[model samples]
Target: DDIAEAVISLEIMRDRATAHREDFETLYAAMHGLYSWFLRVCDADGKEYALKQHEQLFETWGATLSGEQSLSPLESAGLTQESVGDVMRALSAASKYNQELKEQKERMSGAALNTCEKVLNPLKFLLSNGATTARDYRVVIEKTLSDTEKALSTQAQRSSLARLPMDELVKIQFRCLNPALAFRELVGENGARSVILTSGTLAPLNSFASELGVDFPIRMEAQHCVDMNTQVWGSIVASGPSKRVLNAGFKSRSDWAFQDELGASLKEWAKVVPHGMLMFFPSFSLMEAIVHRWR
Candidate 1:
């Protein structure tokens, strides 16, 4: 049966990890077993004989989280066992990081993992199950975007990172649906409080509907920009002689020696802008090089 195969797969992992059974690898494998078992039961087309063999599993056990599934998670979550394992590890690390963040001192490595976990957990759950635990979706939205921002920040290229915040791009995946999970929940009381999957052109009343899963009817919406004028809208490029093509727009500010001058300009701008802006440096060591010729 698909269910048995799934469980066996996880158990094998557990057996290998018994030396450290409670280790992340072990817990992840266990969760994987539980999750994949549900998938096989819902698959009428996957393996008929196996589905029949384990159909009783669902009948005997309480309905698992059958109400949460989506498609994007399936694709983005990846398929290779190692890739899945790596992502799961990143997510688990992120979850631990988020929990610790609510308290005290932290692991720098975990900071990135925490955000990645937030992004992937809901996605993985949806892929495995057919419905999303709304809470997981929100977490994915939060961490995925944060990590994306962090990843992008480390890069010398911002223009290529795209315009939408990392969070929005990551969360865009929740729009995908998992039919089997939806049907499983619709069979009984284990379904969502309400689910309205429809389309409309004009709708955006709720404030957090997009963030929260509350926006009953998901659809495209018209946008209205602020009456206020653009305060600041620009771009940044990598700083270095070899990558000097970036000096096009800011010819006056282009001299490598003028790096300090740019910082001073930022300071001057900050006197009025307060904490609204941010200044990024390639590396702290570059401080001497940049400031020495400070523009």
Candidate 2:
């Protein structure tokens, strides 16, 4: 019953996605469907489902490039048989890696990492021009499958438990939370002799540089091109039209009275602000909440 419901939901999403002409939307629907199906099957069979999925993906892509198959877009885009073969090899390595993790209790081996890196050229070619053709979609699907295997490899490597729970494994999100580390990786040794960062938004330069783990021997702040007195008009309003405190802090921003007062203030401003008015909110959810309250 759960699998049937998931299939129905995926069909509905695919229908809606196809209604639009955008390829990314269709791709999103397909990925969502795959994930939904995986969740259900994983719940039923745990680790075996993941291993089987990897093996199936490897076999499917391998078959596509086998024999005298018509490779239209791939050949037209200058992707040689050898480049596509790299992606196939990566998929095979990924399947092997998953099997090893599941059975032999092995982490991501150096050989597996090198094999995964070998597909970078093919993946880049497929992703260079926005995914439009069926060939692009096929390569992308294989790339995503390979990436998921790599993510699972990482999870298995970092985890201390003998086996990671299926639920937790399914929910794993790979993200770079440390900006400093990312910056260091971006500016590797000998990559950049000197990095000059300049942006109007970088007001607190010290904090920004510290966050990036970089040091600038020479730092200069350029003045605004336009005279502030003549061109820009800025004001801080502590209270709204009703003299209600315009506190947009976490707790008070949602207060009915505060929202009402802010709306009233904007209404008055709209009458005199002339051509247009731009309102900025700290976050989209907060803006949505305020708009809902106003309506």
Candidate 3:
């Protein structure tokens, strides 16, 4: 009976995969044509803008850099010190904005590659082989199908919007409402001897186990090896060595003063600490920004 049910499920999955593959092919062709149009438009705009004005501006800037010309030309052209400063700041902002766009483009490309490899390729192979059994590949097939369906939904919406004439694109987000289903899929069906989950933050063991839909037959709560009184100590560092308040709030976290003070405090600690020290940040981006500034 179970084998028959599995065969039925596999048949349904094959039908769905066939439909999704057709839709993806159509969208891919449309996007390719649209992208070609975009490239032509960008090329025309670049030639017009760069040849007319930016060419001269860049020449003047280069001359100034090489000490072959003075700021007098720019000043004579009605550009003041403040105006030049503003232009530099604007260029800096544009550079950062372009960098963010590049990163987003790379992430989207990665997602497309994952869908092709995990969903489309596997589905294609299964269909070609005329496989009827889902017992072995059930977990992989279900996960990939779910991912492809979600991607197709998002792509369809985005493709519709792309057909319209718009200056900015609307963002569409897909969030998982039931995280436990994903956890259950990982641990429920697949046969394994034992699954051990170890983490310092898994304090409420009962709730964690319940969420995972798994029972721990043997549980152990190990004590800290270091003595809290002598070997281990903790303190709240409200201010840095420079006496600047260590406020890691959203607005203050990015401030140069705060970063400098924090770095200075860490350096002092590193000098005194015996073996090593561990520093934690609220977020990876914040840590990256601080480290970039230091470098």
Candidate 4:
């Protein structure tokens, strides 16, 4: 009965999305459907429904891929496959994306509401880009993100957008679990046949390699796209008017005099810059206070 409800909810959402023909509406419907589906799947005995669905779809695709059998594709199923081969490919992508969605849900449990966007962004990309036949899957990704955002908004203490970066966007993270050990387990107990880690910021290769438990890893530096010496600029302002050290370190964070000085410095900087600028405060309370003072 719950499974039936979930299916019905998704169908209704799909209809609404089609009617609206807007990404936001489509995404909302998809997210709502996923939330319903998640509730049902999580309630199922042994929580095996979602896993079984992916596996069964995978087997169907595998048989088609191997030319063992042929099945008629139907637009109703969103299969619309050109042939048994196309159907199989579509099914394979759907299966993979579905699996990813499941993983994302599990990982996001108990996480801050604001963190949902970052967590769901990768799954969204996988469905929208790599999973061509997964129109339904793509919808689910959008829906999940929508649901997550809504959930996070209810939390009064969650970090605001200015402070957070979606993992899929910036491809950087801090103060979170390292994905290295998980990657090691995924490729193999030992590791993949060949593992390549390349990033411009991945300098001090030894430090990174050691953290990932890689032994004697080969390293190479790619050619720079521009001259760093000519392009890069920096500044240091270490002292205040009285030659007293000016710092916003944790020890001096709550000092009102320090904050006032910092604000004055920022105001001076703003006057020099013509267009616009951004200021990052350590905490929301501090930002609110600064803004109030400025006003």
Candidate 5:
């Protein structure tokens, strides 16, 4: 009965994957058609206005493909499911490529702009391909993505996008990091008698167990080496003399006013701090925006 259900699920996944590929191809064609139109039109105010509109629409299409734009809760609920993690990952990846396209559009001119294109190209085979199961496929894809991002970042020409060859391009799909199946897959379906997962601060045993997909894994929180309050130096500066609230969100990231305020706060904070101060952001894009402001 379990095997039969699994088979049915795989069939459903296969159908969905095919549909997604077709949807991507259609979007690519529409965007390409606009580009072609832009090329043929003689210099005119109407043509310029139409081209700008086409660029905006193309960006929207990319956002839709990447899942940065929202869908109904019912539609996106499967985003957490291990079975469809790869699908979500692939869709999420559209955002990265979309951002890349937006950044490069202004730079492409003449022969560069005329380069032949592959719309919604799927060079990497989907896990639905019979070679690998979803369980391990997520891990493999995540590792590969990490390596690819690292290589791209370290390249001398920082602004250039990492262009993968045709063979590896298909592999650039997203993979869910917290798939919640590591324990079961590692221990085997029969279950292991003894397995230990330990950390210095493993509080909230039930949540940890849920994340690991293990039933009631034992938890132990070690005593702190030093008082956290004594060791940590934290300060909150809500506003500077300008009396502007210092906060950051997707909408606020690009606003010069917000970036200026945030940048000023960080610069002041850095001046007082004697040691290294680590900062984190909700996304790489936001982090890059702030960093650019600092530069």
Candidate 6:
């Protein structure tokens, strides 16, 4: 019986691992299922009654019922038919633990909801010319563990779970753009031509905006903004490349003969060398015109 409940609990958690909104629901259902099971096989008469109740419950719920519930430690013990005193103790302990878990879950949920309001509502409430009010909106995370900590001055960290049909993704969204920036997939240099780097702190943006520079550059153009919060940076480069290449995801034609002839003609004007040979036709139309003339 204990083993059966363990199996059921694992299956339930596995099913629910993808969602946060239904986390507690999963927990309750799992405990309820297991708890009901304990009464099912409690005795022949009680077991039959429990089984009937379970059948009715399953029928009513059908596939709508979650299968991702977990059994608490005490509930786990209660599932096993050990000593009567031991079983009682386990059930009592499990109930107490569940209550504490409920309280903590509620706390985090409320905190997270409030954080959402603070971040999103202001965007809607645009800064009017009206006066502003000061309220205690910041978080106050009170930890009672051995690790000492200071008062929280900002929002708390939060993780959200997205639920798909059979999968779940854990996501963390930044509430404020603080400290560092999160960049996406970087573009690679297909062929080198020119490269320029600049930053607000750069002594001379035109000279060379390296991490640290002692290199050669006769000219420079850069100045820092006195404002402690203002900063800007960028890069630029020039190159003369003339190369004909076919790369992955190129939605071109299947006419290999036409491609080969076009490549040969391009090699005639600009050397279709390994890497450094890029045509700088004014635009796509100009290139197409040239291609038409060549063909």
Cα TM-score of candidate 6? 0.15
**Which stretches in model 1 have alpha-carbon errors above 4 Å?**
1-73, 76-86, 93-111, 130-295
Q: Across residues 55-163, which tens digit of lDDT does each residue of candidate 1 receive?
A: 2112121121222232333333243323445556644653554455454432223433343344445444444423333323321111111333333332213332123
Question: Roughly what TM-score does model 4 have, to 2 decimal places?
Answer: 0.30
Compose the digit string of candidate 6's lDDT tens values, residues 1-295.
Answer: 2222333433333354333324433333434443344333333333232222223112111111011111122244332212223323333443344345465432223332233233223221111111121110111111111233333222211111111111211111112121111111011234334435444555644343231222335445544445445543333322112344432122232234334545665565365335565555545764674466567
* Root mean square deviation (Cα) for candidate 6: 24.5
Task: Tell me the lDDT of candidate 6.
Answer: 0.31
Candidate 2 lDDT score at position 211: 77
Clashes of each: 14, 0, 0, 3, 2, 16
Better of 2 and 4 by lDDT: 2
Question: Sort by TM-score, best first: what order?
Answer: 3, 5, 2, 4, 1, 6
* TM-score-better candidate, 5 vs 6: 5
- The candidate 6 region of ten consecutive residues with least summed lDDT is 178-187
User: Which model scores highest in TM-score?
Assistant: 3
User: What TM-score against the true fold does each predicted structure earn?
Assistant: 0.22, 0.38, 0.40, 0.30, 0.38, 0.15
> Where does the lowest 10-residue lDDT sum fall in candidate 5?
56-65
TM-score of 1: 0.22
TM-score for predicted model 5 compared with the true structure: 0.38
Alpha-carbon deviation at 69 in model 2, angstroms: 58
Supply the global lDDT for candidate 3. 0.42
Clashes in candidate 1: how many?
14
lDDT (tens digit, per residue) of candidate 2 on 1-295: 2222322332333344322223222323333343443343335343322322343223221112211122343344334444444444433544454445544423333443343343233333333333322232331111122223223343334433213243233321122233664466457785677787778888678888887777777999888788979989878999988798999885577678888999999999899988979999999998998899899
Q: RMSD for all candidates, in order, please.
A: 19.6, 20.0, 23.2, 18.9, 16.2, 24.5
lDDT of 5 by residue, 19-137 (tens): 34443333333333423332222122233222222231122111111222111121222222232344334434433343454545322222211221221122122223222323233
Worst 10 residues of 3 by lDDT: 139-148
Better of 5 and 6 by lDDT: 5
